[model samples]
Target: MTRDDLIAMLREQTPACGPARNALIAGADFVVWDGLVPANRHAGVFRTRMRRSLKRGRTVDGLANSVDILRRAGEEPLRTGSIDAVDRSFWFMIFLNSTATAVVACFGGRRPITMESAGL
Candidate 1:
């Protein structure tokens, strides 16, 4: 789909607060960054740094659980047709954002919320 199509779909389907929306926003940011900088110069480094950042001050199990949520939530948009085919960098950012958002939403609260409970 075109950029405008993607944006409209995102606005329509993404919740006010949740993993899907977080991933969409992150994907958008990645698109912008990819346009400005060569992916070879930044993508790997960014991914590694983000992983380490998420691991800091968090348990491995918590991190793993967050990752699982991210994987599920990130694919939902694509599977539902909110997004069309995208490049590897776009997918990476979606996963990164979803994972990061999940970690925050899950661990930041007294109790972890499921993807359904998160309102998608």
Candidate 2:
């Protein structure tokens, strides 16, 4: 989908996934992309390998819950978005499954050294 369309879709989502949806979609200093590209280096989503997964147990932690949620999607397409926000920048990921579910998650943090001098 087009970048604007993708962002618009994300803006219309509810709290099905992350608790920080509103802030994530608010006044983004930089536009988020489906994947990291040269144009915007600070925020993007991409398919990633979960290094460590917390298996099922009697009790579940936040990480476990997130894992289990994604697990239910099985081998279905899943993309994780990692944001390294500098100041008012923003980032988030939209996960879609076969059951027509959408899980949105986001985070913000200091921009990396690579983006220090790079223009938005």
- Among these predictions, the greatest TM-score belongs to 2
Model 2 C-alpha RMSD vs. true structure (Å) is: 10.0
Reference-based lDDT, residue 80, model 2: 40
Per-residue accuracy of model 1 over 21-110 as CA lDDT, tens digit each: 444544532232112222223334434544885666532223344344444443232111121122222121222222122112121112
The positional error of residue 2 in candidate 1, measured at the CA in angstroms, is: 8.8
Total backbone clashes of model 2? 0
Q: Residue pairs in steric clash, candidate 1?
A: none
Output the lDDT of residue 18, model 1: 37
**lDDT of prediction 2:** 0.34
What TM-score quantifies how close candidate 2 is to the native fold?
0.35
